[model samples]
Target chain A: MPKKNLNKLREKIPLLEDIGKDGRVWSDLCKQYGVENPDPPWRITLESTCEVLNEGACALPVLERRDEEDKLSEEIYKDVPYPERQLLALAHSMIKKGFFREEELGVQMEKVYKRLSAGT
Target chain B: MSKSDKHDHNAAPMVDEISDFEVLEVAVRELCIEKGLFTQEDHNEWTEYMHTLGPLPAGRLVAKAWLDPEYKQLCIDDPVKASLEVGIDWINSMPSKFGTPSDYCNPRILVDTPTLKHVVVCTLCSCYPRPILGQSPEWYRTPNYRRRMVRWPRQVLSEFGLQLPEDVEIRVADSNQKTRYVVMPIRPDGTEGWTEDQLTEIVTRDCLIGVALPRADRKADDKRPIHKAVHPYGH
Candidate 1:
């Protein structure tokens, strides 16, 4: 078989920042629908990023923290409403956007665990 | 009474007291609420909406379609509109008038034919048609099912006790986008003139997901080991 040239297919996709520079369309849609417009573009970006990345791979993301988070989400939130998983995903995304440190999450988890165990 | 004597034998023993995941859920929900991402009311309302959801409406949609050819065509052409016939207004049913944030308004009914079959999987995350079909099954959300269902659909279906002929094509609808899907399997035999309720009863959640076919005898999905929750949701 002859070698196929793949240079044309390797063009760089525009960065999310560049793509989100003009937010008029999205803001208009949000306004029309009575939904709050996502402030930091990261809200949509993180979700799309996960979708794009997952499209190519057969398995879930292998990052240790992500794996643990997903496992926990499945164990605890599987029977609950879908928003629980959504919130967990959003939290991770916020962490990615530097809203909070992973270490901070550990401390918060401990506090929350104590409160929950105490039946507060 | 001794310390051991106080323990009631009838009560279930506590397993892992407050797992890390439980802590993380609380931490994340609290942090998000504190950050003003969403209020506790919004979360509660969404949960309540979820409680109202189940596979019945989807099952009815399939049954109605099976009985009426025009409705079946309508289901193929405009599924969101078709959903209304079964009393599921995809847009206005939930707390969010626009639709559930995760499961957007766009829902497509993948109608199975004699020669073709359809199944759904969200390889990225479990993006199910929750507004209509309710919460996805625990197994469906697993990475193992997500991965294998897309790659080796035949093998996966066989494991679910669903084996089709070689000539019949198996299509795995990867719901990686905003558009969700519910499989409408071809109406099964042994019900030539059955009522809509009778037909709906046979179209179990598994049939809607295209895992198991609707049979006259089967009223529920195949029995699988259910992972008992440490603190199961009452609703």
Candidate 2:
């Protein structure tokens, strides 16, 4: 199947000017409903990506910094639900636990490619 | 060549090559199994669990709520608990005892009233209540839908053939975090004594997503063109 160019698709959609980098639109809506807004999804993705990459480079432990981060802002992330974030977090945890070396991923991926090509 | 044969020449290429994403997915799954994160049986069980999911359970939940007032309050107050009535245990239903790691446990049922309407969109990603509502529609996952639905909801809704009165308030619920949402539309008129089964038939997936409304005569969503997968699942 052909992959979609999401960046191109996003350009066609009309967005509101009030949708700030902090996700004010979501925050305002949550405020109207009397519920606390979770930190912007983009921010969560950004942080997760950074954490995962850092973990991959130098086997660091999972940062239990959610509590500190939550207290820093009124609109803070309460939970991580994004699939990419979940996948990255899992990889990060596994790396930290010494399950496998980050460098070995390329070799494993090649084996997987061979298996797929062989229709196994 | 014939016109048909000429048309086939312009069609998308059906390549047998595995993509990098496919290779990576297999590599990760295999590595996870090797590391004791999960077994092959667990992965197979999860696939089987996914096959059992559809819009029927979510529709039944709405139907039951519409038939019973207390149930409607339960739906609004504690949606995860209310999901139990439809046999969807968000936490323990999947392979993971806690919940599906990506979807998490929180589910909010947005109950619509005469003066208020609710529509859901995940501006960052498509965070759907898959346990009950099944796979999200392709349109829902599109960047166009994600960006436009949150900002120009009325315009987008109208494009989906749903138009509300000027006085009615439209709330666009952005499912950006753990809280997944399912819109429970108000029971339509002319179905005062309808059975739960009958009501459930009308509450289609589109209604649950708040793109359309249930009608006594309409038991299905408006027909739209489907993008056929090159390799459909379970083939």
Highest lDDT scorer: 1
Clashing pairs in 2: none
lDDT of model number 2: 0.63
Candidate 1 runs further than 4 Å off: A1-120, B1-24, B225-235
Model 1 lDDT, full chain set: 0.65
Interface RMSD, every prediction, one decimal place = 17.5, 16.4
Q: Which candidate number would show the highest TM-score if scored against the true structure? A: 1
Interface C-alpha RMSD, model 1: 17.5
lDDT digits (tens) for residues A6-111 of candidate 1:
2211222222112122213333444554545332222222333332222223122324334433443544334433223443544544465445666677678778
Per-prediction DockQ comes to 0.09, 0.10
Candidate 1: CAPRI quality band: incorrect
lDDT of 1 by residue, B110-189 (tens): 99999999999987767789888876776776666776788889988888999999999999999877899999998888
